[model samples]
Target: MKKITTRLATMDDIDQLADMFDAYRQFYELAPDLALSRQFIRDRMLGSESVLILAEDEEGASAGFCQLYPTFCSLAAAPIYALYDLYVRPEARKLGAGRALLLAAEAHALRNGALRLDLTTAKTNLAAQSLYTALGWQRDDIFYAYSKTLAA
Candidate 1:
């Protein structure tokens, strides 16, 4: 296994991040659309809508990535991060890339004075669940997460 390095992604990394992002969507059973993925990542990076972190192995191959969106916690009265996406390449599994990315995201959030960081994953993604829990991420059992689809 190679050493994993993580850093805040910038515009220069969009191409690499987009590739990883597309693969991530595929992991969720979404159709592969590199162009859409690239454009979406480009919009976020250019607009500052989220904090993106990219991970690379010792050899500098794109290993994985995690994206954190900033939002206010009304009750806590402070900002927080919604870790909306985390993905590690299949070949990079068990190499600490995911953990490194998660830690990087946490550091970014804390550095910005965030009150907490939250995320949700497919219940069937046992590997991700184990990784998250092993890294001290608490599983929420209180309120249920709800969402509504709006026409785009």
Candidate 2:
């Protein structure tokens, strides 16, 4: 495995990040639309709506990326981060990029005074569940997450 490095992404990284973002949506069964991917990532960066982390391999190729949204957990009464997206390129799997990205996200959250970092993965994504477990993330057995689609 090659060395994987992670850092907060800046506007200059939009191009590479958009490419991986497109793949990430495809991983979730969304139709591929490179233009849409670029615009969405650009909007986030422009609006400062989400914190983006970029991971790169030793040769400086895009390895993976993670997105975090700063929000507060009402029960905790403190700021927290929702780790909404985490994706490693197909070829980058098992190279430690995912782990590196998650670590970077946590460091960022802590530095910003967040109480904790939270994330949800598909029930069938066993690999991601395992990684979260190994990283000391505890599953919330007490609450069942539910959501309803709203009209756009």
List all candidate RMSDs to the true structure. Answer: 0.9, 0.9
The sequence of per-residue lDDT tens digits that candidate 2 reaches over residues 87-128 is 999899999998999999999999999999999999999999
**Each candidate's TM vs. the true structure?**
0.97, 0.97
Worst 10 residues of 1 by lDDT: 143-152
- Clash count, predicted structure 1: 0
User: Which segments of candidate 1 are over 4 A away from where they belong?
Assistant: none
The whole-model lDDT of each prediction reads 0.93, 0.95
Candidate 1, lDDT over the whole model: 0.93
